[model samples]
Target: MRTLRASVLARFSARASSTLAFDSTSHLDSLQHTRIQDLRSALFKGGAPSRIWAHYTNILNYFNYDVLPLELHQQVLRQCSPPVRSVRLSDAKRLAQGKRLEHRHLHEGRFQAIISNIRALGCTPSLDDYHFILEHFAAVGYHVGCHQVYQEIIHLGLTPQTKTFGLCLQAIAHRLTLPTFEVFRMRLVSQTRKALDDLMSDMRRFNVPFTTANLDLALRIFKETVDEEGLNKLVKWTYGIDLDNPDCSPLDLLENQTTSSPQPFSTHALNTIIDTLGRFGDISKVVQAFEVLSQPLPQAKQYRFSSFDDEDDFGVPVHVPSPSNHSLPYALPNTTTYSMLLRHISRARHSTLARHYLIQAFKLDRQ
Candidate 1:
């Protein structure tokens, strides 16, 4: 039994020595030194994830390792330096206090750098991370940044949630749309209109919730393009109203509460409808739109109306239409509403109707 144990111990010692000799003689030390040098080169670059990743690849190649350890990968990512424009908490607070325009640019650059670094490190950003970037771009009205983030999210094999999808639509719309100018009008107005319609259709296809803001975006497109057919369909979906139905007036749609609760229309929405009608519809259509705006909303909801707090030198308060109180049981027509009505009346070449509305507008303003 002692001879057997001695034999086993000798075999173990011989195997260990052979392993050590192979490691010493087979360029293992040189390979290790190369890896250390690569790591140092990567780290000394001051936090560039791509450079670090490349260095890591070199180390793997030298060692004939297919992949780095996950722990080491993460360590390299954590050590990477953030971009210079990334605002610290205190710097952000200061920027917020000052309300500088550059804040948006700073945030945009930071998000870009973060996403690039994350990708360089082979890390997949989650939905929440992508949403944060998208929302920031949307808030800042930087449609280009929004699109860049959106494309990256798609490329990452991730599905966009409802809000992300909505933001993408908004970003695309903002990019395609240009401010209307009298001197140099945009030539792509028709193309933009088509794109907007397609986006709205996509929203419906995806079953995105029809929030007020989303509806407003759709409505704005309809108004801009004078797509009355589209507007009617939108109204039918949003408020369950069919304007063509013989029994229902536009005001009736707002008044009848027997069905599901109608989403309240903003004064801006009312104005948009009136404006659209003024541009394309006949005299009767404009009149119908005006009457709807003139109707007072339920007293409970009246406070939704925005007040013009400014007073004349005589202390006479301006009685403008409340912005939110488009429906009424006491809705007043705002200047915009009156202007739309008058413009249409004049366009129809109806002198008597124009005069009538003008006089009524003056009376309402005085009140």
Candidate 2:
């Protein structure tokens, strides 16, 4: 998902989008293509803003304003804008102390300038273009900007894609979880719930299965809001299960439901479930999940060229028509898994249980 990729990349300094939008760039010649790419790279690779802006003029002249695809306009606007790095409270405070424009305002100005840049390029902003900026706003911790851009998209009657909701939801979750936001907790809590619910509902209209990244973001939104009802609502939405199924627990919904999304199994998802259970003082469920993780991964014989033990697709020896003894290999728990469990056990302050997990982790790690 575009939303997922953007969120992950936000941790690092912002760079140009390597991916292009769903449009026609095929008409452009190789020279034109390479020039656009060079401009994109130069945007963040270190250069003066004035020179970058000038390069934009050269591109326009080079194309002679012929066949300016929406993607080119979008990338130009997207790249020419400033980098969206993490904004700390300290940074905000530092900006407030200055008489110049605020830090966030500087961010706002660049975005507005890019919109003007789009018009200068004789291109109307497409839905994908707006989504790019919305994602950008979300990345820089400006939930309000994300909401405003989203509203404009709706007002323009542009039907949003799934990534649209993902960006807004992720923005809300990221902003609300900040320590600085705690003071306004009571006022924002109810509003956040309604807005989040609305976003989810809007996303469902597309009738597409949520990507695992989006689902993970939803999990975070529910957790931060502490909405048990919403948690069950997510379970109902993803899987056909609800509170009516008393035997079913949220942990069961931890799996990636749609094959179109993340991997079938994620140790991260498992760890989150384990951590949630521990938070609820549900020690039994935590232990159950841990035991499942602790189970020995199935082993199989490794290939040995000297013995001619390698097998073909049908599991027959390549050199001979004999059945291969090797079995399918599986992934085992990694250091991260063991580290999460160890911390969880340590928090409960159960020395014997902690010792057991540590010893098991020690033995379980092949590395």
Candidate 3:
């Protein structure tokens, strides 16, 4: 019942936001100002959740849902369901006072109840509102709550935006990291698989394409769960290759490029992909990814350590081989790439492989 009411109101967040889309009179502004101020006070001044709740109810009663300004309502939403960053600060404060953070149901109930109340007042919640709730939950540690909110959005026949899918992927990935949830690891992986299926269906339904961010979230989950097959599918997806085709080469992305074209894999982006593969204990793939990036354009005066022990710490000549591939992304990995590879390779207990990377890193320090 609590979840139901929250879901109902969750929809209204969107509707209520745009209700007075173009204009709000002085009458509306004044009514919202006091309550918004009070809500902000409670959040920042270390007021108890009970006090925050009090200010919240006052806002509801003051506007009667009919004249609730979007700013005020979003403020209440922040209090009721903060993103992970806010939750961490609030929790830290609670810990200092030797109190647990507020109970889950209080927040869940309040969040949905806001949506329900908005709808009861005959304001339809907008899609933006639904995304707000889901995004908050995605960050707030209510990983599954993101799904619950998403389910209700669908139940109400609401069309979600691309960001919604990204949020849902984030939520799905988060649970796999929690120690308390480790015992349910397989179940969490399965949940991600289901979310992926739902995402594909929705993609077709709305004609919305999935973004790299979406693929990255799913990759995070697969990385945690050590789901090699799952990682393979997404890695293929990430490179714009067909899942069923065996003939595709990641190198194809480089080959199709025009000479001197824009480098597709910037160093930071390639490092992220390398890190993802690293997480999967696939150092070979990591090295392949690193190699695939066109070596950085050589500096006119290349620098290398005189030797490992030379404390000079200045640029010296270190000749780097030029790329044979005429068309490839001209990005090169940095020390971080070395660190990621070493971390994962060491994790697999292969000291020799780790040592090889350290040597490679020492050789590449000219960058």
Question: Which candidate has the highest lDDT of all?
Answer: 3
Worst lDDT window (10 residues) for model 3?
Answer: 240-249
Q: By TM-score, rank the candidates, best first.
A: 3, 2, 1
lDDT of 2 by residue, 141-201 (tens): 5677777788877876788887888888777777665445457687667767877787777
Better of 1 and 3 by lDDT: 3
The best candidate by TM-score is 3
Across 1-367, the per-residue lDDT of candidate 1 in tens digits comes to 9999999999999999999899886677777777766777667666565676567656656663323444454445444424323423434565468643332334454445445545566677677777766655554345556656766776788865667766755654543343334443344446445555654565555555567776777776666667677778777666554545412434544555324445665677677677776766657876865664457424534455444556666789876643333333213568988888888888889999999889988998898
Q: Candidates 2 and 3: which is better by TM-score?
A: 3
Prediction 1 TM-score vs. true: 0.50
Q: After superposition, how far is residue 306 of candidate 2 from its true place, in Å?
A: 52
Query: Count of backbone clashes for each model?
Result: 8, 0, 9
